[model samples]
Target: MTKVRNVGGKITETTKGNDNSFAKENITYNSQKKISFTSDKGIKHGKPETLPPPELPSKCKVEFRPSKSWQGEFGFDWCRIGDSQLPVDKPYSDIVGKYGAIYATSPSAVFTIKPELYQRHLAEYEKFVLSAFGTYYVPNLSLMKGEIAVLDAAIEIKENPDSMYYKYDKTVFEVKILEKLSNTKGKHFNDKVLEIKCLKEFSSKQKIELIATKNKIDNKIGQINVLPNNKVKEIDILFIPVEHNGSSGTIKGKEITILTNALKQAYVKGNIVRHKEKIKVGGWWYDLFFTKKDDKGVVSMETSNIRSIHRALDDVFFKEKDNEIYKNHYRVYMLTNSTSLNGMAEDIGKNAKVVVVYNNRNDSTAPHELMHAMGLYHTFDNDGLFTYKFQNTDNIMDYTHQVGKDRFSTNTWQWKILN
Candidate 1:
């Protein structure tokens, strides 16, 4: 490989090979005269017994450099030659034309190299140098440890002032190579069903029974049955109060009331019944089966709420808005601790979605959380918009109850879930 060094001392690698077995020769003329050529083997066996000669003008000079590739199977070898500086009016073609014969050519059709052709060859050389060393002109190309190579080259120049003499020179090149790697992986998930159990104290108070009264528990259970494959199976909620009014008890009377009332509100007013039928719910410590055989298949989800209960709600309630197949078959969950939004749905559990709010809060929190549960991301997350700052305070996702913020913008990332 060819190694090039840049002005900044950076080295670049090229695809060219390192073999350099070449030579150069020069020819000069004092007066107008034709020139001849000869093969490296010094054998002149062609169609014509005598070869034609080239007409060289007065005071003209020429230089020649030949290069060959060791790996070349065909005629990939090439040569570069330069002529002495002459007036524009000089007829230089006549001189090189004769030299073509010596190099093996016919008299009637002598080959002559043009000035433009020479310029093109020079350009190619410059490009090769830049590619190998990283820069064409610089302070000096830097040579790395494994890049040095000895080259066998020659430069031939001919002048016209007096008897012309040819000059030859040799040079070496050092190169280096660099490599880089990148990583790009998307999102993924493994299980589907989310197991949940009610806090022990809440369950002991017959919270499920008390909540059932708000909207006829039997009727809601029937509605849950309507769900395909009885996707949502409710395991008896068991609540264990880790902390109760700074006292320890199997079941506290006041705690039961609070638990029952919370359940009632969550089921009746909060519309938990509709979701129960569509999602599978298990006791807090129950074994969750999230395999393909389960009614709720593989689920894709994201979450900020790490609480087990909230995660369970997400699996049971969330669905994607537009994803028809997975939305209909699987369950997604977005566990959130925010009390601003209670829960949201997209066609219920028919699509992959989220359940934003987890902490018990005011009624308004349900809608907001549900909005997120319905597969709606934050409104402020405008990914590629140059004008929008990702963490800006004005964004709706950043809005807090203290600010009395409760509005969804039409031009927000949240809209993507709907479409």
Candidate 2:
């Protein structure tokens, strides 16, 4: 038979006349004694019914004091065992002293966890220890649910700068997660997209006048809603110079002599002279007449004479009264004699437009005049020309003689205007 009795409010039993039973009954223990115990269920338990959580698992905290010897030096002092120093190879007292010496010599340093921050850290520490021990267990779901609440409270505390301690100590610092991300937020679309427009226009002719203003054209069309897929219809152009009448024909004998002499003088001076004549008289002239029947032709013709060159350009092809005569589309007028129709455009606004090179010689001159007929301008005038350095050569705009032809270079600005 077995007799049962309650010891320390727990049930235990013994068999009648068993030696084990007598040993169990006779075994006396002191209340203050620390001993290991095993229950009948074969479970081993620690001597203490409960234990204070690990004060320091891997990391520890210490109060920091700046050193008087240096402006940015610091020292540490342990305030509480669980709240301050962590358990490491060295005892808490020894570790704290060593850290203090290290802090005193170093510049500003950050102390990781604060005393009030320990609760959250301790929970994290428990997880770390469990993982280190290879124990797999789902954490308390309640803890996961409370994460956001914890973060919110921490943010509020961090924003209140006064809530943090060690206000005067510069060498020691604390960084909180919430404080680091305090001012972060989503960006607005307006902030992301910025609009900027830079526009410029240049021409060799001074003060360009518009036969039809852009506002007038826009107003003519009226306000029409433009749909995403719909596009503006193309229109025909008029009054653009495509071809010229002056490139051919025998001038009066005296005018021919004047043109011949001008050419010879330009050749002797090493300036690019267009004609092979020995003498030249009267001004040179070329007419530009465009032949495109549509409005697109007008815009195309407007681009000629970009650089300073002498020639007369007439837009007879596009401006003709009969639309049937306006199909030629393109023309180039070039004149290279200085005195032949020089500055002709300034004189007869009707018959001839001339670009005169007053006292300049360089191979760039002929090409420069042709470019003018093509609606191109000098490289320097528009702030678009880039040269390694300004040399004492003819200003592509100025009619000055250049010693050599190697002194010329063109950049994209000129190319775009020509095209």
Evaluated with lDDT, which candidate comes out highest? 1
Give the whole-model CA lDDT for all candidates, comma-separated. 0.25, 0.24
Q: Please give the lDDT score for candidate 2.
A: 0.24
> Considering summed lDDT, which 10 consecutive residues are worst modelled in model 2?
218-227
TM-scores of the candidates are 0.20, 0.19
**TM-score for candidate 2, residues paired by index:** 0.19
**In angstroms, how far off is 257's CA in candidate 2?**
27
Off by over 4 Å in 2: 1-336, 340-363, 373-376, 382-401
Model 1 regions more than 4 Å off: 1-283, 286-351, 362-376, 379-396, 412-417
Query: What is the lDDT for 67 in model 1?
Result: 17
Best TM-score among the predictions, by candidate number: 1
On residues 1-419, what C-alpha lDDT tens digit does candidate 2 reach at each position?
Answer: 46665577644566677332133234466566576675577965454433332221211111111111211001111111222111111112211211122232134422222333333222321121211122111111010100111111101111112112211111111212222222222211111111111122112111110011132221110001101111211211121212223322212223223222222211111122223221222223222322223455431122244333322333222243553442431222232323222221222112222333322223344334433543443322222232111222222322333333232222222333332
